[model samples]
Target: MTTALLLIDVQKAWDDPSWGVRSTPGAEANVARLLAGFRAAGRPVLHVRHASANPASPLHPDQPGHGFKPEAAPRPGEPVFTKSVHAAFLGTGLEDHLRAHGITGLVIAGITTHLCVSSTARLGANLGFAVTVVSDASSALSLDDGEGGRIPAETAHRVALAELRGQFAAVQTTDEVLAGL
Candidate 1:
């Protein structure tokens, strides 16, 4: 089975301190490592960039932070799918591209574990793709617990992975995926 890498929204916006502390300090490094591995393996790579419509958001197209992070930037000729929605497949033609390319397996990595990454993984599974989410290659920012407490970003990250385990995608670390490859 041919497996492609889907890197979702690894943008500079995630570095904005306004979002608070982020989990998985090594996520970008791991993502970079995976990117290199995929390139070495000659596998297809798809980069997903989120362009938020909200002007105040750092991810807004007009904002500097909307640009891709250096480590995740696409090389010339690499396919980049831009989306405004949380799911990379939504209105992004990602599904069509995967179908046309006959890609049945996906290795996903990127920012905000519980949001775009999670959403994309779930949708990928729904579309019948065997998905693997690299845990150490993705992260989550601290979140409001809604009970006058804050959830640690790492805890939230772990929960997101736990939620996606088995059903939506197989969760693994970057090292594990690399070793398997």
Candidate 2:
């Protein structure tokens, strides 16, 4: 199927360890796999970057770190959405860009499994586009009290995967996504 791969918010902003929600382990490798697939297929690989209202945060629109990481920077002609909110469509022309290319399907891969990834997945479904949430390619930070109390990252990741599967978007592993697309 000819579909756009929306690499949601895989920026240095979210990569900060201070954030409770960052890339899950192996996330870089997973994103690398998805990027490779999209490149091979000659499919559009769109990046969603957030511009937080907080001026001090690395995600501020004017901050240099608000862009994509070097590993997955958009190539020439690739679309990049600088969103002010969780959903990429909330404050950007991402929808119009997709429509212009006749993209009716989206494969999502990015950071913060519970934030931008989830929000955009719901919107993508509501917008009537077929959506797939790549399980391995997205991540949320592990919860911890630092007193030897913490929820396992894998467990939290599994929960996000289950939640997005039947609702936000169809959840699948990077390999599954590769096979489908």
Candidate 3:
């Protein structure tokens, strides 16, 4: 079975502190490791960059944050899919590309674990792809839970991973995935 690495929204905007403290402090390093592993294994690598339409947002097209973080930047020949929405497949043609390339499985990692990463993974599962989410290679930001209390980033990240496990993905760590590959 062919597998591809899907790195989503690992952009410079995540470095901006205005978004608040994020979970998975080692996420970037782990993502870099996953990238290196995928390249070494001669596996396909796809990137999803989030571009906010809102001019005031850090991820707006005119902002530097719209570009990828150095550690997760795509190489010259790698495909980069840009999207304005949360799910990578929404308007990106990512699923089509994967199908065209005969990719039957996906290893996903990225920033905002509870958002883009989770959305993409769930969609992938529903589309019949074998999905594995790298826990250490994804991060999430803490946000108001709507009741005036803040949900810690770590909690959100863990909960998202848990939700994806078994149902949407097989959650694994960087080391575990690399060693298996």
Candidate closest to the true structure, highest TM-score: 3
Task: Tell me model 3's lDDT, rounded to 2 decimals.
Answer: 0.95
lDDT of 1 at 55: 99
Give per-residue CA lDDT, model 3, range 121-155, as digits (tens): 99999999999999999999997999999999999
List the candidates ranked by TM-score, beginning with the highest: 3, 1, 2
TM-score of 2: 0.87
Q: Quote the RMSD, in angstroms, for model 2.
A: 2.9
Considering summed lDDT, which 10 consecutive residues are worst modelled in model 2?
A: 14-23
**Cα RMSDs, all models:** 0.8, 2.9, 0.6
In candidate 1 the C-alpha lDDT for residue 100 amounts to 93
> How much is the lDDT of residue 164 in candidate 3?
99
Q: Give me the displacement of residue 176 in model 3, in angstroms.
A: 0.8
**Given candidate 2, what's the lDDT at residue 41?**
85
CA lDDT of each prediction against the hidden true structure: 0.94, 0.82, 0.95
Clash count, one per candidate: 0, 0, 0
The residue-level lDDT of candidate 2 at 84 comes to: 79
